[model samples]
Target: MSGSFSTPTLSTEKTFTFYSQEQGNAYAQARPDYHPTLYQTIIDHHLDSNGQLETILDVGCGPGNVVRALSSHFNYAIGLDPSEGMLTTARSLGGTTSASGLIRYEVSTAEDLGTTLPQPILDESVDLITAANAAHWFDMSLFWASAARVLKPGGSVALWTSGRNRIHSSVPNAAAMQSALDEIEERHLRPFFEPGNLLTRSRYVDLPLPWALEQPIPEFDESAFFRKDWDVAEDFFAFQPEVNMDVFEKITSTASPVTRWREAHPDAVGTEKDVVRMLRRVIERHLHEAGVEKGKEKVKGAIHGVILIVKKKI
Candidate 1:
């Protein structure tokens, strides 16, 4: 049930770059961490292709979640994001790098790839470059060119994002609940969605690969490209299989489109007319119709996921 598509666009100043300290904190609290298998799959694939594990650069690393989680595996870990608020949150949640190395965060963009940082990343030194749930926000053609410069000859680039979601079959009146969710997306969120959101919703099938860009980056080995997809039953989201309504609401509120909607209708926020609150009311009504006791209802949903892994030419 996809809507209209837009040309892929970069993460613009008008969007996530506007994230304030409070917004970033709320984002960190609401978003689910990537599943361990997601990381391991990237690592195993990279290792199988003889990729090194010395320096990692996670682009668009909001809240530094990926870098912090993968810190122990690499000697040096660097996270870059355009938002200072997100970087600040990342720094506060400090994690350890290798004994002889350091963990750092820089306010930077995927297009920059740390070249303009006070301490620029070493050219051809990064062993793994990752963009988790963030690549759709990039100008991929530019990102690939920058990746070529920052990555070692056999380094790997891993990009992953979850697709548009659905209510899990376990939820009461799951079909009707899904329709309500879809209705919200159509009536409330779609208008505010940027092109990047469309790409993620398409599971990156519409995203450009290095070789497919206007000025193709030949440094990547398209022949060895790797992609994996997980369906609703495949556990890609890694969020709790069950959650209370309040927790569910927080999760739903973190969506980029919803953020845009809230921004546009500040007065409606928290009122029954608010998109989130409206969703809650509908959900509550569904629960009541399904004979759920007050405060006893739970919500769980399914989202497809896809990961794209490309290796720099050896």
Candidate 2:
């Protein structure tokens, strides 16, 4: 799985900077929590018979979801993130001290962990490292090397993510919903999914972390994990009626393409309300075609991911 490749650089622009304390708190409330069995499975496979796990590190601990879930299992846990707002939300969500008074939070990036934390967590000191949804933003080479430096021999690293299943059976118009997905793919996702694009190109490559670790990464084991699929009625309506209106308005205002359009017209900002009004009309029409009724049905789908009990070569 080795290859010559250039990693895609993420934009540091503060576009998503608004995912601050308020946003994080909202996300914690709205986002689904992971199943407890998932964590147990990872522990079962990765930990020894004594069932002891100490010194866990959670990278990208958004609102401390993973930390809160797994903290009880470890003697000491640290949640690290670059976003102060997110850290604040995490702290608010019971991400404080461990039972043994060993838990802590650090503000740092994945690559700078050693420098940022007071007592540098040494090479082969950590027992487990987990990154959820945030691994995609990391510099793989640096992350892998750093992770290896901080982890003990035979330590584990887990990467996980979940996405909305928009094509569930609970929705009223399944065919129309699929059509919408097709349209989104055709109009939005196609450009990114094209050959040579970042997503497509990196799908097959061994990620930077594994290569950097200088160890043979184990094959992903899915049987040790649990997966579930469900319907999301609330998400459907919120997107169709509530937040989508505001989101569309803001995106048109802030995004480069639409901002460029506004620049060309000069009078566009004055008519912004009308623009939102018209956009709503278009969305409403599409929803009608898709047989979407307010509060009628909810979005549904399956969610699945692996929980690997990774171990570094001794």
Candidate 3:
């Protein structure tokens, strides 16, 4: 019942496929929601100047988490994702109908956005552009250039991602996790880290603030943002009795290990089941080692994020 899943060779020709619509819906249910403070900070940093936030664009908006979180702030919000399954889930998450009819969902790739929005919509029409956790998948150069084209002169772009959650803060455990990640990177992700590797590495540039729209903006503050670290044993898994396994399955299905294994062993029979088993074991072992009791199955971890604010250069 237990066997190591063979790592797959990386390839650029691979097509990224996310979980099914059912899976995406389940994921939307189980995944932790972002902090409200984080949303307020983003608004303060980017949209506060106008006195009233208007149009917003969410790129790679998986299941419309950002859209749901910020729908009330903007006059209108549009969410775009490449996966139809994800978009379907997003729409179902009250995205299709909001209080103001301001939320909309589009199926589109971050790299190819033209298909998603018409020229009129792209022409300096948006006030804010935000990507949460999805920025890493973008073609940085093209995406930034395209984003610049669509954004109003004074519009703001916010990119933020959450780091891995760890259960313990002990130096030894931290070091061990680091080492484990390093080994995985070297053994599985390294060859793919290069330009032509399976996973494309794109450099992100510091977002430029617009000076044309002068609205009173708050000072860039990192401390105001939540800086949290958790021991998964204590924080995440302890609530396992209430933890939703369906959500866990959906999240794991999108993991790099699962996707890479699928690509590497495309012809392998029963690959999907094998991938699932392997992921469950990996997650369980990591959780256990992090101090969660075995058979008690839970996850604990910490997350730290930053908020940046800048006015456009006049």
Candidate 4:
């Protein structure tokens, strides 16, 4: 999913600057969408007695995926991200349903709450705030301060990361295929992952939170805030369908490390012998040896997610 290189490994700092318009397009086009049921679960867990939510804010809403998926539950929804490129792609691609209320996107960082948000998003006004596959990049100190400022008395905050150890295939040669994917990560991508990514690599257990410490941040008073891991059942249904080889390759290309690799070695991408194409050739050969064919046999996998939810006092 990336160009091959025999030179020294590229620095992970590239990732922080990787969200170009083209990169944003590729990410929006290839990344898997989250499950609607996951949004429903968050809603059911926080709905008031009347089962209504007035406003929702999604922080670090890459391409506005979570907002697009969960907007239906609230009277109004807003998605905020620092990446203007991502917001551009999101506005062009996001959709709405009758069940959903008005949705908007903002080019704002999570730490810049008041300056970037509308007055209606005042202190203690938002019912729910979520960050999916994004909290790892946040300055938790600033984020917690902003989250506390905007959340309503009984509001909820949910953070989650998916696509970690998550994909499992049902193909006959699933084990071999899984191994191939693992090798791609271990050999080609893992080294480029940033320290903040430890939260994702550890399946969210290492995610930073104000309430996780023995002395919780004053903003998240221990008596007022409560936390729990969202139970993603071992047998949770697959979030994505069985995809053909081309689609799988596209998905892999959307990965940050792969994108960074391409950026660092632009001269090598999209060529006949590009690293991504080479990787694809190897994986395809493995599949063929196992009786799978390109464009014919579909590869399926289960996506795993780890979520943590915290509720503020009313």
Per-residue error for 312 in candidate 3, Å, reads: 4.6
Stretch of 10 with least lDDT, candidate 1: 1-10
lDDT (10s digit) by residue, model 3, range 133-198: 555456444555556566665676676655343324432245555456455446643443322222
In each prediction, how many residue pairs overlap at the backbone (N, C-alpha, C within less than 3 A)?
A: 0, 5, 10, 3
lDDT, candidate 2, at 301: 42
lDDT of 2 by residue, 182-244 (tens): 564455334433112332223322444353434533432223332222234332121233334
Model 4, TM vs. native: 0.82
TM-score of model 2 (CA atoms): 0.67
- Residue pairs with colliding backbones in model 4 are 4-275, 166-304, 168-301
User: Which of the two candidates, 1 or 3, achieves a greater lDDT against the reference?
Assistant: 1
Off by over 4 Å in 3: 1-20, 48-52, 96-99, 111-120, 165-167, 170-250, 266-293, 304-314
Which lDDT tens digits does candidate 1 get at residues 133-226? 8888887777888999999999999999888777778788888977886887788888998888878877999878889776889999999999
Model 1 segments more than 4 A misplaced: 1-13
Task: Give the distance in Å from residue 135's predicted Cα in candidate 1 to where it truly belongs.
Answer: 0.7
Better of 2 and 4 by TM-score: 4
lDDT over C-alpha atoms for residue 304 of model 4: 54
Q: Write down the lDDT of every candidate, Cα atoms only.
A: 0.83, 0.54, 0.53, 0.66
Rank the models by lDDT, top first.
1, 4, 2, 3
Top-TM-score structure, candidate number:
1
